[model samples]
Target: MTTWVLLRGLAREARHWGGFPDKLRCALPAGDTVVALDLPGNGALWRERSPARVEDMVAAARRTLAGVPHTPPYALVALSLGGMVALQWALEHREEVRGCVLINSSLGRFSPFWRRLRPASYATLLRLLAPGRAAIDRERAILRLTSNLPLAEGTQQAWTAYALEAPVSRGNALRQLKAAALFRAPAAAPGVPLLLVASERDRLVSVECSRAMARHWGAPLRVHPAAGHDLALDDPGWLAGLVADWKTRVS
Candidate 1:
């Protein structure tokens, strides 16, 4: 049985994983466990100042995981900025990380700035960073950029409530962005089995970036036909199946 530590992207809390965590847990082999930990300055820790570097974020993640009763050789399943943190963690703590599954994530060393962040979303990202925006509007904009699914009214309402309940400060948001932009993955991939899952139609980050990284690492790359950046949101079952299959092959 393995300990699967799940991580989310900027300003997104563990709750943002929606039903995916449950799905993955059910799909995993017997006795395996899934745990989602909030990065500093998001969700339960919204008041904390987020670090401006991915390495520090990795340290924060390690601290959060210290309390979980999990065994070593942990499997890391992380998306976007969380994937960046996972990469750094795997590189620095090879003894603890067994393997990594990165979803729609980009590293500065492999991708150009425009590809790491699509130029088309520049205005949307800037608007998301603006101060004093209503919670509902901000969440709606985020949904638009992250998922291809037509959000149900209930989903939007729920996200609005989540955002209002645990608002991320503008400062923390900027710090997270800085951390992502500054993160530079090593030229060589981490010394662990890796699986790369990406959305071919991702708008926030280019799919080519994932393809390039997979090529560099000689890791298997699975492409979703139409999902956006939030591949889990768009197709949870498919994501789970792919992950389960990868686990089987690795095991």
Candidate 2:
């Protein structure tokens, strides 16, 4: 069975994956196991201090994977900043990472900052930078920016609970953002197979970043014509389908 290690983006944890894991399982070949891990200062590791550097975050992910009982040759599936971590891991530990699937992810070394994070999102993002905001309101704002799909009141309520239960402190969130900004990928792409997925309608991250990154890396790009930045949440079926197809081709 192939092992898939899933990682979420800035200020988000494993629980944020919602029903996407199961959707991926259904799409992939049978017996493939999916494991979602939380970075420090998020989810299960809420109280821990998050690393301010991307490489250190990669080290922490390595440690977390080492402690878990799993087979070797993991496929890293990550979104946004987590995608940055996955890219680093694949390059640093080539033998351990068989492939990577990057979603709405950008690299400082490849794209400009404005494209990595769109200028349109600046005002909303700045408001979220400070602490003391109500959990529900924060989730609502996140929902608006990240996903185009309509979220039910109950879903927002659940997200609020997750936000409250293992809050990513404003300080940690900014630190993570700093790490993402500082991370510069190698001039040459890693040798491992990579599949890049992007959402055309993404509001937070410009889709052009992914397109240009794919062009530079020589990786295949799959565009979800109308999804938002949170492609998994906006259209998990399409995302999972593309991943499964890519996996089959790579295998």
Candidate 3:
């Protein structure tokens, strides 16, 4: 049996996976188990302060995985900040990871501009958008940035509700921004097969970032034309199918 571990991006909880887990499980062949973890400051760990550094988050992830019943050599699928963490983990614990998939993420060394401005700009933006109303508006703005799919009224409302409920503190958000800004993949990636997924419409992290990583790592690259930064949320079925296919190919 194979084990797959999922990691989510900034300010997002495991619930942010939406229906992707179930969808992936259905699409996956039998004898595979899926585990979606809440990063230190989000989801099930929302009450905790966001970690101050990527290493801190990585430690938390290691501890979480250690508690899981599965043995070593798990497949890792990560998005955005989660992708960065996954890359670092694969580098540090190469022998324990079987395969990796990164989505809408970048290596810190790739984009000089983003690396420079991310900390300050993200901090400012978080402060400016920390209120519940501001968070709702940010969600709308995010919807605009990534998706052309006309979001159903009920779906939008539900997203709005979740946004309001999971409002991130400015300080914690800043910490996450700092972690993202500072993260860099190791000089060489793990030897395991890797899949890099990019969204053509992602405004947060450009497709070029993913492309560069894929080129550097010699990993397979996949792109989705219409999906945005929140590809999993925007199209869980598509993302799940891709994950299942990647699992099969890598296995």
Candidate that scores best on lDDT:
1
Residues forming the 10-long window of minimal summed lDDT in candidate 3: 115-124
How well does candidate 3 score on lDDT at residue 17?
Answer: 76
Point out where model 3 deviates above 4 Å: 115-129
Candidate 2, residue 57: the lDDT equals 93
Clashing pairs in 3: none
What C-alpha lDDT, on a 0 to 100 scale, does residue 47 get in candidate 2? 90
lDDT-wise, the better of 1 and 3 is: 1
Candidate 3 or 1, higher TM-score: 1
Clashing pairs in 1: none
| Reference-based lDDT, residue 27, model 2 | 90
lDDT of 2 at 80: 97
Stretches of candidate 2 off by over 4 Å are: none
Write model 2 residue lDDT over 192-233, tens digit each, in one string.
Answer: 999999999999998998998898978899888888999888
Query: What is candidate 3's lDDT per residue for 161-201, written digit by digit as tens?
Result: 77677666667777887898778667676777789998886
For candidate 1, the TM-score is: 0.96
